[model samples]
Target: MPELPEVEIVKLNLEQALEPGDEVENIEFLSSKLRTQLCLPKDIRWPLSINKLERRSKYILLHFSGGFLLSHLGMTGSWRVEKKIKAQKHDHVIIRWKKGNFWIYNDPRRFGVFEFGVNTLTNKWLAKLGPEPLDKDFDTAAFLQSLKSSQRSIKVLLMDAKVIVGVGNIYACEALFRAKINPFVKARGLSSKKLELLLSSVKDILQTAIKKGGSTIDSFKNVSGEKGAYQKQHLVYGREGEKCVICSQVIRRKVQVGRSTFWCPRCQK
Candidate 1:
């Protein structure tokens, strides 16, 4: 699944690949069985140019003159730029550009989103999301207060989208490891200072992940069909039983809330 960093990379790649005056020739849906049938608003003006691209959590928001295209790369989705007009096996949607290129949305699991709508900020999925970890609006004082009131384990709390968006399973593990905080520690049991450290770790890890083109755990790729190399840079998420890079202690992994949580027993205690 594409997490915050992966989604952000896709948004950035799209922003770079697409131009302001590059008009959309057509929006074609090759499949109707995504998480839901992706529907385009009927009132959209024809041949509109892309205005901008934005990412909220894991959703990519493509701005246009008439409206926006909102999509989520649920588990196995990706967008690839190609001049080939023919759709591949999992290519569910295609935005045919006027200049012979195509923005292809492919998903083998068919669990992704490719929908068009008029309003993005008012969309329910985006509207209910909490503050972005990298945004200035993620007030540290308020976050500390929230952490003090929650009984969930620190890693699980960090992964909660309602509490803070974009801290996915891999990132939560990596960030917790970076913060030297045990994954099983209760949110309420953590000190404000420790929580601050965790917050910083999350931001730094995510920004670094984006810089590395996001992790390619499964099917994530940039808009240009390039595979990400960040998975090779993971500290603990997939390094269970391996020597901890910092303290040389053996790394550990456990399933918490159905997701594998990784940390160093000695370094992250």
Candidate 2:
């Protein structure tokens, strides 16, 4: 699945490639089923012009003159810009522009979504999401206040979309490890100083991953079909049983909320 960094990369690429006046020449839905509540093909208004592209959390918000086109690249889904060549088997949605550009949505697992709405903030998925981790509004004081009421593990709290958006499992583990905070530590037990470190680590890890084009662990790829380079720079994630980079202690792996979490036991208290 594409996380915040990956989604932000897509938004940036689309913002550069798609102009304000670019018209939606055509939209083709090859698959009968889309992992969306609303029907995209029928709900989306035709003859729409592109306004801008934005990302909230992991969702891509394509703002058009008429309304918003929301997309969620679920597991194994990607958006690629290609020529007018033959469409592949997994190319479920194709958006052709008037200037001969083709934007193809390929999803092998068919878990991706394409929905239409008038307002993005009023949409079901975007409405309930918490503050974006990279946003300036995510202040340290407010963050500590929010953590005071939660008894969940700090790692789990970071991954909760209702508490903080876009801190996925990989980045959460990496950030926690970088902050020297154990993933299993309770949210309310964290000190203010530790929380500050965790916040900074989260932002740094996320920004660095975005700069490296995000982690291509398994099936993630950018709009240009290029693999990310951040996986090579991972500190603890996917390095279970390996020597810790800082303290030379062996890294460990454990399951939290049914997801695999990696950490350096000695480095991260």
Candidate 3:
């Protein structure tokens, strides 16, 4: 699945190619269903001009003059801007712009979504999401307060969308490793100093990953159909059984909350 950095990259690329006045000339849904959501093809108003593009958590929001287009790229899903070409087998949704450009949504697992509505921010998907980790509002004080009452594992807390959006498994492991904090520590057990370090590490890791176009662990790709390069810079993720770059100890992997977690036993305490 595409996480925050990946979704943000898609938004940036789409914004660069799309203008405020570029209208959606037509929409074609090659698949019968988009994940669990059902969007009637005729419900989409033709010639709908795009107003802006925004990303919250892992969801992409395409602001239109009348309403909004919400997209969630589930596992193995991606959005690409391409010229007229033969559509692939998994090309689920295609939106033709008036400028002759085509925005194609491809998902091999058929888990992506295409939802349309007005006042979308109040919807169930976006209503309860926590503060964007990259936003200025996600300060150390606020983050600490959010974790003050949680006894969950620090790594689990960090992955919670209600605590901080977009800190997926890979980034969570990398951030904890960079902060020299064990993923198994209780969230409330962290000291103020350690919380500060953890928060800073999270921000740094996420910003750096966004700059690198996110980590492509499996099938993640940018809007240009290119793989992300941040995976090569990972500190601990996917490096299990390998030597730790910092402490020379073997990087260990464990399953936490059913997600794989990587860390250096000697370096991360």
Candidate 4:
């Protein structure tokens, strides 16, 4: 699944492709399970231009003249700009412009979603999310306060969407490993110094991943249809049993909150 960086990139890509000045020629679903159940039927009506392309948490918000289109790029999902073409097998949703052609929202797993609602509900999906890790508001003090307020394990705490948005399992493991903190450590057990390192690591990892266009594990492609280069930069997420990049200690894997977490037992104390 695409995390914050990937989602933000998608928003930027979508905005560049479908700005307010552009006119929507059409909106259709090639194959959607929620054709009617999830989103309002493809109401390709006139006078509907994207007023803003925003992202809240991991959800992409497309504010339009009439309503909003919300998309969640679930696992194995991607949205990219392309010249309008015939619908492919898994092209769940297609949005066309008056001139440049179309954009495709393709998802093989069909786990991705497209929902429609009024602009007033933008907060609905973003409301419960915690501060963005890359935001200036997510400083050491704030992170410590948030973690001290919860007793969840550090790994689970990192995974909490209400604590911080977009730190998925992959990034969580990478961040924790980078910070040299044990994923199994209790949240409240972190010292101020360790907490500061953890917070800094989170920001650094996320920003670096974004700069690299996000990690492309599978079925992930940037708007240009190029796979992300960050996967090659990974240190621990999927390197179980491999030598740690820092200490040469063998990396280990464990289940935390039902998600795989990789770390170096020697380096990550």
At residue 7, give the lDDT of candidate 1.
93
> Candidate 4's residue-wise lDDT over 110-227, tens digit each?
7777877775434466656777787765555776898988878898998898888888888889889888899998889888888788878888888898898888887678777777
Given candidate 1, what's the lDDT at residue 160? 85
Q: What is the C-alpha RMSD of each candidate to the true structure, in Å?
A: 1.6, 1.6, 1.5, 2.3
Residue pairs in candidate 4 whose N, alpha carbon or C atoms collide under 3 angstroms = none
Q: Give lDDT tens digits, candidate 3, residues 1-269.
A: 67888889988998888955688897777877877665654666678878788998998998877678888998888888877856888898888899888999989988887887677658878888988888875666788988878879999999999999999998999989988889999989888898888888888988888899888988999988889888999979899999999879999999988999999999987
TM-scores for all candidates: the values are: 0.94, 0.95, 0.95, 0.91
Candidate 1, residue 58: the lDDT equals 91
For residues 1-269, write the lDDT of model 2, one tens digit per residue: 67888888888887777855778877777877768643554555567787778889998888877688888898888888766746788888888888778888889988888877787667788889988889977767877888878888999999999888999999999999889999998989989899999989999999999999999998888888898888898999899989998999999999999999999989887
**2 or 4: which has the higher lDDT?**
2
After superposing candidate 1 on the true structure, give the runs of residues whose Cα lies further than 4 Å from its correct spot. none
Judged by whole-model lDDT over C-alpha atoms, candidate 3 comes out at 0.86
* Candidate 4, poorest ten consecutive residues by summed lDDT: 34-43
Candidate 1 structure lDDT? 0.86
What TM-score does model 3 achieve against the real structure? 0.95
Candidate 2 wrongly placed segments (more than 4 Å): 41-44
Model 3 misplacement above 4 A: 41-44
